[model samples]
Target: MNTFKDDTLGSIFFQVMRLHHIRSHTLMGMQKIHRGQPPILGLLWDKDGRTQKEISEELHLQPATVTVMLQRMEKSGLIERRSDSEDLRISRVYLTDKGKQIKDNVEEAIKRLEDECFDGFTIEEKLLLRRFFIHMRDNLLKVSEYKEI
Candidate 1:
């Protein structure tokens, strides 16, 4: 019988997650979406005109980190930051026309990565795994931070 030695279930989970992250980065990088940008772009593409703070919060990224990525993206002509009319201090992120044009392609790249990762999994199995992972995440969260689904 063969077994993975010195690896607990949690360690295996961590390894899988790391691999998933690396795979996602490679897949998205091919489309010129750097390691830190896809999640930000994904959010904006899904619903444009979000505050920088909101993007940071939604993606669980630091505000400073988001700012740096936003700067890079702005330089790449992918997004523009505009001051809020009511609160000039708050900068809202809007995708450029170039960014909008690539949204579908970016989404497709991400979908390809996801589909590749889940290839061969039956729908029932995929659903069960999703439920398990969500439950595990909820278990790790504080009671007040988690809502039952």
Candidate 2:
């Protein structure tokens, strides 16, 4: 196995993040879901009917990107879009039976991934690590001068 020549924190952290992303991508692929679709699905699961604009804003995704994702999801029979009863201009997205049924499988896959990521870590250690991550995130946000993203 190859090892990093530069042992800096940033380099190590980048490698960890890359590997985590790759693992997550593969895990999601196994569930027949795309990389960015889980969160959208989760949102819809939480509230079955939401407008496209709501989803886009809530997820902080570009409207065009959300449109494309919704298009693909609609084509795949995972979600259906319908005109709002009160407003014809607005479209609401609702999960199909397939989409609703996949919730359990998607959740299970994520849980497995999380378990793997925290393998061999005690409960206390996990809690501490979570705190450290939150601190790191706050530090970055402060330096970037973005109070909210």
Clash counts for all predictions: 0, 0
Give Cα distance to truth, residue 137, candidate 1, Å: 0.7
Question: Which regions in candidate 1 have their CA more than 4 angstroms from the true location?
Answer: 1-7, 143-149
Question: TM per model?
Answer: 0.83, 0.91
* lDDT of each residue in 10-116, candidate 2, tens digit only: 88888888888999999999988887899899999999889999999888788999999999899988999999999999999999999999999999999998999
- lDDT of each structure? 0.83, 0.91
Query: Which window of 10 residues has the lowest lDDT sum in candidate 2?
Result: 1-10
Candidate 2: regions farther than 4 A off: 1-3, 143-146
Error of 2 at 15 (Å): 1.0
